[model samples]
Target chain A: MAAPPHFTGSLGYPPSSPSPRSHLHCLSPCNRAIKVSMSQNQSYWTCVTQKIEDQLKQLIPVRPPLLVYEPMHHLVFTARRTMAPALCVATCELVGGQQPISPNQALVVASALHLVQAALFTHEQLPLTDRPIPSNPETLTHHHAFAAGVELLTGDGILSFVYELLGRSDDPAGGNSERLLRVIIEIARAMGSEGMVDGQYRKMLCSVLGSEELCDVGWVDHVCEKKEGRLYACGAACGAILGGGSEEEIEKLRNYGLYVGKIHGLMLYYHNNRTGGEEKGFTDLVERCTSLALKELEGFNQGMVQTLSSLVRASFWDKC
Target chain B: MAAPPHFTGSLGYPPSSPSPRSHLHCLSPCNRAIKVSMSQNQSYWTCVTQKIEDQLKQLIPVRPPLLVYEPMHHLVFTARRTMAPALCVATCELVGGQQPISPNQALVVASALHLVQAALFTHEQLPLTDRPIPSNPETLTHHHAFAAGVELLTGDGILSFVYELLGRSDDPAGGNSERLLRVIIEIARAMGSEGMVDGQYRKMLCSVLGSEELCDVGWVDHVCEKKEGRLYACGAACGAILGGGSEEEIEKLRNYGLYVGKIHGLMLYYHNNRTGGEEKGFTDLVERCTSLALKELEGFNQGMVQTLSSLVRASFWDKC
Candidate 1:
C-alpha cells in the first residue's frame, strides 16, 4: 500500500496506493516507470503538450464575447494532461512523416480532438441531479445556469472548430485534403455511439443496473475498452492516418493505443473495484496489450518506436 | 391575443397568446402567414420534414446496449421541427443541384447539424444547479446521474456520426472532396464560438447580468443572430456549397438563411420579451432580411426560388 519508492509529485499519482474511491494511480512497477520515463522524456512530453496548447491558442479565435472562450481556456490549459495530443504527435512522427500534412497539422486536428474531450470532461462535472436551493438560490442559480451554458456549448463550439481546422486546410504541412478528411472521419467513428459514447453508456449501466452483481472483469473490460480505449486508439490511429501511415501501420498504432488505454483503465480504476478478476488475469491482459502495441511499431522510425514503446511499456513494467 | 384565423395544430404554436414568461408563439402577422403558408405549402413542409426524418431513421444506427441509443432516438425523432434540415435540403435544390453529392448527402450533413442542435437542446434542459434531493434521495441520485450521462453523451454521439457520414464520402452525388471539406468547415464556423455557442453564451449572460438594462433590442437581436440566425445560415450555405453553387450563390443562400433565422428569432422569443424595439422596428428588420433573402435567389431555378422566397415570406406576411 505504500507509495513506490521513486514515485514523485510530478507524476500526479497519490503518495500511497489509490484508495477504494481513488481512481488515478498506476501499479508500482508502472508507477516507477512513469517517474523514470517522465525524467527521460520530460522534454518530449513538455514540447508535445506545449505545441498543442500553442496551436489551440492560435486556432481558437478571439471574438468580442469572452464568456464562451474563458471556460474553453480553462478546460484546455488546465487539463490533467495532453496525453491524446502527445500520442498523436508521437505516432505521426513514427509513421515516417510521409503524409502531405505535417505532424504539426496532425496536432491541429489533435487539438480539436482534445477540445471535444475537454467538452466531455466539463459536462461530466456538471451536477447530475438537481440540488436543493440554497438560502441564496439566486446566486447559485445564476452561476449554475451560466456555467452550464458556457461549458456545454463550448464543447459544441470546439467540435465545430475541428471541422473548420480541416476545412481551412491551414496545415503548414501543405494540403492533403483526402487524408485530412479521412482522419476526421476516423476520429468521428472512434468517438461515435459504437465507440467512446457507447463505452460511457455501458459504464453507466454497469454501475446502476449491474451493481455488485455484475462488477465482473467482462463488464469492467467492456467499459474500459469503449470509454478510454477507443478514444486513445482513435487518437493514435488519427496520428498515423494523418501522417500517411500504411493501412497496416495505422492498424498497429491503433492497437497500440487501445492497449495503452486498456492498461491505463485497468490500473487507474479497476484495481480496487474489481470483483472477479484475479491479479494474474489483470497482469496478463496488460502484458498482451503491451506486446501488441509494441509489435505495431515494427519498421517505423527506431527512435519514435522506442519512445512510443517505452511510453506504453512504462505503464506496465510493474508486473512485467 | 386570439390564435390567427388559419392557424391550426400543424403550426406548433400555442392556440392562445404566449404568457408573460412563455416564449414560443410567433407574432400574429407572422403567425397568420405561417397558417396560410402552411396551407399553401402543407405538402412542401411535410415532404421536407418527412425526408429528414426518414433519412435520419436510417442514418442513426441501432445497436446493443439500447440504453445509450434510446435518448438519441428520442431526441432525433421528437424534435420540434425539421427546419434546419429543411433549409439545407431546400438550398441544395435551389443551388441547381449540379454538384456530385446528392440532395441526400446534404441531408446527411443537416442531420448531423440537427444532432448537434438536439444535443444542445438536451443539455439545456439539465438543471444547471443541483436541486434539493427529494424524499427518496437515492432514486433521485441514480436517475439524475443516469439521465445526465445519457443526454450529455448522446449529443456527442450524434456529432461524431455526422463526420462519419461525410468521411465515408457516401455522397451519391459523386465526389467533390474540396467542396465537401469547405462545407464541413463552414458548418463548423457557424456553430463555433462566434456562431451558435457564442450566441447561447451571450444569451445566458444577458439573462443573468443584463436582465434589466441590457434586455433591449440590441441584446435580443445579437443573441438571435448568433444562436439562431447563424445556424440557419450555415444550413443554407452548406446546401449551396455542396450543390456546387458559385461563391456568390453560396453567399446569397447563406444570407438568406441568416435573415430567415432572424425573423424567426424575433417572432419566436422577442415578441413577448422585448423592451426597446417597437413593433414597427421589428417589422422593418423582418422586411429587410426577407427582401435580402428573396433577392439572393435572383437567378436560381424559378420554382425553387419561389418556394424558398415563400418560405421566408410566410413568416412575415403580417402586413399583407
Candidate 2:
C-alpha cells in the first residue's frame, strides 16, 4: 500500500499514497532500470510531455471570457497525460515518421488527442446514474453546481476543438489529406459510443448496478479493453497512419496500443477494489497484455522500438 | 402573442404563447403567402425536415445502456430544428448541387450539423455563471442534478460522434476528400471557442454581468450574429462546400446563414424582451439582414434560388 517513492510525483499520480487509489502511482518509469536505457526513454517521455504541454498551452491561450477557457485550459494542462500522447508520439517516431520534413504534424495531432482524453476526464467528474441519486446528498452549494456547469460546457467545447485541430488541413492539395481524414475517423470511433463513451457508460452502470457483481475479473478486463485500451490503440494507430506507416504496421501499432491501455487502466483503477482472487486474475491479464504489446513490436525493427517497449514494460517491470 | 393561431404547434413553438417568453412562436413560416410559393416552400420544408429526422434516427439508434443514448436521442429529436437544417438544404439546392448523382451527402452533413446544434442546445439547459446559482434554490432533487450530469456526458459524446460522421470518408480515394475535410474545418471554426462556444460564453456573461446593460441592442445583435447566426452560417456554408459550390458561393451562403440565424434567434427569444424603440431597430436589422440574404442569392439562377429566398423571407415577410 506504500507509494512507489520514486514514481509518485513524476506523472502527477498524487504525491500522497498508501491509499487504496495508489495504483496510478505504479505506472511511472521503473526505477530498477533507471540507470541504463530507461533514462533515455525517460528523457524522451519528459521531452515529449513538455512539448505537448507547450503546444497545448499555445492551443488554449488565456483569452477573454475567462470562465469558459479557464476550466478548459486547467483540465487539459493538469491531466496525468502519461499514456496517449506518449504512445502517439513514440509510435510516430517508431514507424520512421517524416521527422526531418514535418515533425510538427505528430505533435499537433498528439496534443489534440490529449484534448479528447482530457475532455473525457472532465466528464468523469460528473455524477451518473438513471436509477436515482445516491442516498446521501451533500449540501450542494450554488457555486459548486455552477462549477460543474462550467465544466460541462468546457467539455463539449474541448471535443469540438479536437475535431478542428485534426480536420483543419493547412494545405488541402497536400498528399496527407486522406491520411489526416482517416486519423480523424479513427479517433472518433475510439472515443464515440462504442469505445470510450460506452466504457464510461458501463463503468457507471457497474457502480450503480453493483461493482461487486458486474466488475468481476472478466468485466474489468472487458471494460479496460473497450475503454482506455481502445483509446490508446486509436492514438497509436493515428500516429502510425499519419507517420506514413503501411496498413500492416498501423494494425500492429493499434493492437499494441490496445494492450498498453488495458494494462494502464487496470493498473490505475482496480488495486484495492478487487478481491484477492480477482486481483490474481487481473494481474495475469496485465502480464498477458504487456506481453501482447511487446509481441506486437517484435516484427518491427527492435532498434526502433525501444521507446515503445519502454512504455509496455512500464506497467510491469519486476513481475515480467 | 397567442401562438399565432396558424402557427403554434407547427415548429414546436409552444402553442400557448400568451406568456412573455413567446417569441419562439413567431419564427414559423409567415402566413401572408400561404396560398402561393409558401405552399411549395412548406412542402419542401416538411419533406426535408422529415428526411433529416429520419437520417438522425438512423444515426443514433436505441441501444444498450439506455442511460447514455436516451438523453442524446431525446435532445436531438425534440429540439425545434427549424433554422439550420432548412438553411443548409435550401442553400445546397440553390447552389446547383449535384443532387442526382449523390444526394445523401448533403443530407448527411446537414443532419450532422443538426447534431452539433442539438448538443449545444443541451448545454444551454445547464445553469451558467461564475456567481451564485440563483435565488430561491428550491429543494434540489438528486435526480435533476443527475439528469444534468447524464446530459453533460451526452453532449460531449454527441460532439465526438459528429466528427466521426464528418470525417468517416466512405471512399477516401474519392475526389471529395478535400471538400469534406474543408467542410469539417468550416464547421469546427463556427462551433469552436470563437463561434458557438464564445457566443454561449458571452451569453452567460451577459446574464451574470447584467442583462440590462450587457445585453443592450448591439450586444444582443452581436450575440445573435455570433451564436445562433454563426451556427446557421456554418451549416449553410457546409452545404455549399459539400455541394461543390465555388469559393464565392460558399462565402455567400455563409453570409446568408448568418443573417437567417440572426433573424430566427432574435425572433425566437426577444420580442417581448425588447423595448419599443429597440424593437423597431431590431426589426429594421432583421429586414436588412433578410435583404442581405437575398442579395447573396442574386448571382445564382432565379429559378434555383426560390427555396433560399423562401427561407430568407421566413423571418420578415410582413415587416418587409
Candidate 3:
C-alpha cells in the first residue's frame, strides 16, 4: 500500500472537490504521489513550512537537532530529566527502611504537596507596580515582601529538594516529610508576626506611628524610605531568583512587582478609606499604587502577562 | 522555707496536727496507726516489708527522690512520654499538607498504588495445602504466573521506588511522578490482560479451550483450587510490608496471606458462576476474590489491621 501525498498548500480542500468520497480519496493519495510531491515541490513545501513556523514563532523553540548530539546539552537535559525521579527513588528507599506506608497515604501526601505549591505560586504576584521606581516608598516595601515570599517558596533549591524527597519516598510514609515541611511553613507564615495578619497590623500601626503628635515626622519618613525602597528591591530580586531571570528580567520583574504592590496597597487603602479612616495622604497613596499596578500590567502582552496579573489580582482579593 | 518534716510510718503526718485537709490525709493517719500497731504487736511491719522486698528483690527499687528516673511499667505510660510527641508531630505534618488539598482532588494517583499493594497482600494467603496441586502440568503454569504477578505487584522493590519519589518532591510538582506511577500500575492491575479481569478470562479459557467432555471436572477443580488463596497471601504481604516487618516476619505474613487469598479467590469464583456461552468468569472471579479478601482479613486483629484491610476493600471499587 502506498502512503498518502502531503498537502502542499492551504490545508483546506479545493472548492471544486465537493464530493465526500472524492475528498477522502483526494486526501489519501498514493505513497508514490507523496514521494513525488516531496521531490518536485521542495520550494513550495518550504514556503508552507515557513508560514506555519511563523505562526508558532512565539512558542519556545525545540532545541536544535545538533544540540542533542552535543555532550553539554545532552548531559544537562538528561540530568534534569533524571533529577526528580532519582530523588524520588531514594526517598522511597529511605521510607521503606523505616516503615511501609499504604498506597493511599502516599497519594494523599503527593496531592497535598502539589496544592501547597499552587497556592504559593498564586500568592506570589500580589503587590502590583506602575510607572517604575522613584515612586512613593510606602508602596515599595509591601510589594517586595510579597515577591520575596514567592521566591522563597518556589526557588529551584526548594522545588528541587521537594522533588527529590517525593521521588525517594516510594512509600506513602515517605510523603510525611514533605507534608511536615509544607505544614510548618504554612503555619509559620500564617502565624508569624510579619505574616498576613501581622501585615494588616503593621498597616494600621503605620497610621498612628507616623502621626505628627505621636511620632517624629522625619523618623517616620526615614523608616518608610529605607524599608519601602528595600522591599521594592527585594520584590525584583525574588522574581529574578525564582523565575531564573536575568538582570534585565529582574528589572522587568521589579517593575511589575512594584506596580502590583502599589495596586494591592491602594486597594486596601481605598477599601479602608471608605470605612471611616480619613487620612487624605493615605488615600492619595492608595490611588497612586492602583494606577501603577494597572499601568505596569498593561505594558506586557495580555497572554504573556496573564499569570502575573492574575496573581496580582488574587493577591488583592480581586478574584475572591 | 524549711523542708517539711519527713513523714514517719505510713501516715507521714504529725499526730498532733489537725486532721489533714483532704481525704488523703485521713487515709494516711489510718495507715500510720495500723503500721504502728502492727510494729508493736508482732513486728509485722518489718515482716511485711521483708516479704515485699524479697518478692521484688530481683527488680531495681525506685529511688525516693527521683521519680522521673523510674522505668515506666505500662506501655501506655512509655508511649505517652515518648511516642506521643513523635506521633503528634507526624500527624500535624500530615494534616498540614492536607489542609491545602481540596476535598475533590484528595484521592490521588498514589492511592491507586496503595490499593494494588493491599489487594496483592490479601491474595497471597490462600490455603494451598487444602487443595491438591493440579496433576495436569498446564494448570500449574497458570497458577505460577498468577502467583508471580501477585508477587511483582506487591513486592518491596516497587513500594520502595514510590517512597523515594514522594520523599524528593516536597513541592507541589513533586507528587506528579508518584501519581503517574500509581495510575499506570493500577490501570495495569485492573484492566490489563493479566490483571484481575484477565485472571477470570484465563480461568474460563481453561474450561472451554480443552475437551468439552472434561470441562466440568477440570473447571471445578481449577476454580476451587485457585480459590482466593493468592489474594489472602497478597493481603498479608501488603500488611506486613507496610507494617515494616522484616524477612523474619514472613512466616506470619504468609499465614495471613494464605487466609486472605483463599477468601478472595472464593469470592471471585462465586461472582462469575453463571452458565453457558456467557459464562465468562469475570463476575465469578470478582466474587471469589472478595470472599477470600474478607476471609483472610478476619485472621488479622481487626483493630491493628483495619488500615490495610479497609484499603483492600475500598480498592476493589474505589476507582483509584
Candidate 4:
C-alpha cells in the first residue's frame, strides 16, 4: 500500500482547533508541498525524497525471504515521509558538503534511520494472539500467515541491515571509518535503551499501568524526545558529521534536531489523540520546541541554512 | 532466573541412543566442563565465560527502563553458554594474537554476538498474547506486566545495543576501525535476510504450514545452517579478522564455524524433539559435521589449535 495520506509530511490539522496554524504559526508542510511554485525548497524536498527512495530500493532489493523483506519494504516505503532523509541532506548542504545530494554518507545514514524506524513500527504494532494486524487488511495487505512471526523477525532483520549499511566505507583503507563509527554509535544510542526504546517502554508502561494521567505533560514530553526527538536529533547530527562540521556545529545541529523532534513528536501525540487536541500545555509545548529549534541555527551561516531553517519552522507555506 | 539446566554447554544425550558418545566418538561439552581436570582448555573456557559475563554487565546496566533492560539482561545472562565468545577467543588465540584473551577486538565482537543471540531468543519467544511467557513465571520471574510489549521492545533495544557495541572504537584514531568495520559487515550479513532470519522464516513456515515433512532432513539441515551455522561462522571469522589472520585462514575458520554451527543447531533440534532420537539421518549428520570441523584446523599448528579443534570436535572427555 502507499503511504498513509497524512505521511505526506503534512502536520495534522486537528478539526476541533480554532485555527489550523494557531499552534505552529506556519503553513502546514503538506500545504507547502502543494504550492511548489511558491518556494523552491518544495522542489528541493522532493528531490531529496526521491534520492532516499532510490537508495533504499538499491540497498534493500527484493530477494528471497519474501516474508521478511516485503514487510520491511512496505513499512519503510510507506512509513517514510522524506522527513528524516531530507533533514540529513539539507543539513549536509548547510555545512557546504561536497556531493551533498548524491548517494553519499548523508543518504546512507538517512536510509539506516528509516530502517530503524521501520523496525520500531513493526515491534510497536505487535497484536494480540487472535487478532492479527492483518485484520486491518487495508494497512497490511498480503501479510496474512505468520503475521506475528514475520513482523517480529522482519524488525530484527531490518536492524541488522542498519548496521550493515553503516559498517560500509567508501575508502577501502577506512579513512572515513572513524567518522562512520561515530555516526553508528550516536545513532545506536539514540535508538537504544536511553532514547527511543526507553520512550517506547514508558509509553507502553502507561498503557499497562492503565493510567493516562501517568503520561502527564512532562512525562509525555520526555517520551516524545525519545520516540521522535532522538531520531530527528540523530538525523541532523549525523548529517553534520558527514558534512565535516566542527564539534560545536555538530552539537548545535543535534540540539536543533531535538527541538524539531519534540515538535514532530507532540504533533504525533496530538494526531493520535484527536480528542485531546485542545488539552492544556499542548500548544505551549509546540511553541517552545519551534522557537528553540530556530534558535539553534543562529550559529550557522544564515544564507546556507535557509532551507533547513524553513523546513523545521514549517514556514515555506509563506516565508519562502 | 539462572540458565535453564540445558544451557551448560553440554551436548544433549538422547535417552534412546544406544551409546552416549556412539555417534561422534567424542566427549560432550557439558561433560568436559564437569571433568575440568582432564583438559587445560576447560579452564580457558571458564575464563572466557567470566569475561563475557563481565563485559555483558558493563554493556547493559540496570538503570532506568527496567522493563526492556531487565529482559535484555535476563536473556543474555541466563541464555549465554559462552559458546560463541569461546569460539571467538579460541580462534583469536589460534591465529597467534597478542592480547587475544583481553578485552580486545575479539572480545567486543563476541560480546555483540551474544547480544544478538539474546535478541533472537527474545523475538523467538513472543508468546500467544493471552498466554504471556510470564505465565511460566518460573522462566520469567517478576516479569508480569506488559510481557509482550516488553519482550518486543526489548528485542529491538538489544539489537540497537549490538550496533552500539560494534560502533565503539578503542583506538582513538581508529587504527583498527577498518577491521572492526569488516567484522561488523560480516556479522550483519550472517544475521541478515539470507542468513539467520531466513532460516527462522523457513522454520516458522514449517509450523505455520503444519507439515512435518516440510522440514525434511535436507531442509532442516539448510535451516540449521542459517539459524545456528551463520552465527558461529561469523563469530570465528570475526575472531580471525581481529586476530590478524590471513584471508585464507579467516575463510577456513569461517567454514569451520559453519560446520560447528550446524552440529550445534542439529543438537538443538534433536534436543527439542527428544522423541525424534530414533529419527532418520541424525547420527550421520553429526558425524559428518564433526569430521568437517576438525579438517579445517589441519593447515594451522596442531599444538596451537588443540583447544580450538577440541571445541568443534566435542572430544576431550578422554582425548585431552
Indicate which candidate wins on DockQ. Answer: 4
Worst 10 residues of 1 chain B by lDDT: B18-27
Q: Candidate 3's residue-wise lDDT over B153-231, tens digit each?
A: 2221222222332223334553433333332232232222223323333344454355555455345434433323332
Q: List each model's interface RMSD.
A: 3.1, 3.6, 23.4, 2.8
Q: Arrange candidates by DockQ, descending.
A: 4, 1, 2, 3
Backbone collisions counted per model = 11, 0, 122, 1
TM-score, B chain alone, candidates in order: 0.76, 0.80, 0.28, 0.79
lDDT score at residue A93, model 2, on the 0-100 scale: 70
Please report the interface RMSD of model 1 to 1 decimal.
3.1
Tens-place lDDT digits, model 1, residues B88-135: 877776666644345657777777667667666555555555332322
TM-score of each candidate? 0.78, 0.80, 0.22, 0.82
Candidate 4 lDDT over B1-320, as tens digits, reads 12122233432222232221111111235344654343444545555666666777888877665656667777666553527666786677667656423236677788888888877766766664523233222235433233667777777788888888887744755367778888889888888877888887787777666565786777779988998899889888888888789999999999998888887777666555434433447667767887888888888865546556556555312111
Q: What TM-score would chain A of each candidate receive against the reference chain A?
A: 0.74, 0.80, 0.29, 0.79
For A1-320, candidate 2 gives per-residue lDDT tens digits of 32222222233222231222111112224323342433445545656666777888999987777776777788777655647776787677767674442346777888888888878877665443243343212112112233555666677778878888877634564567788888888888898777888787776667567757676878888888877798899989988887788899999999999998887777665533544556567667877887788889887865457656666565432121
Top-TM-score structure, candidate number = 4
lDDT of 3 by residue, A81-107 (tens): 101111111122212212334222222
User: lDDT of each prediction vs. the true structure?
Assistant: 0.63, 0.67, 0.30, 0.68
How well is each residue in B92-175 modelled by candidate 2, as lDDT tens digits? 666667544225677778888888887787766654323334321221221233355566667767887888887773456456
Best by lDDT: 4
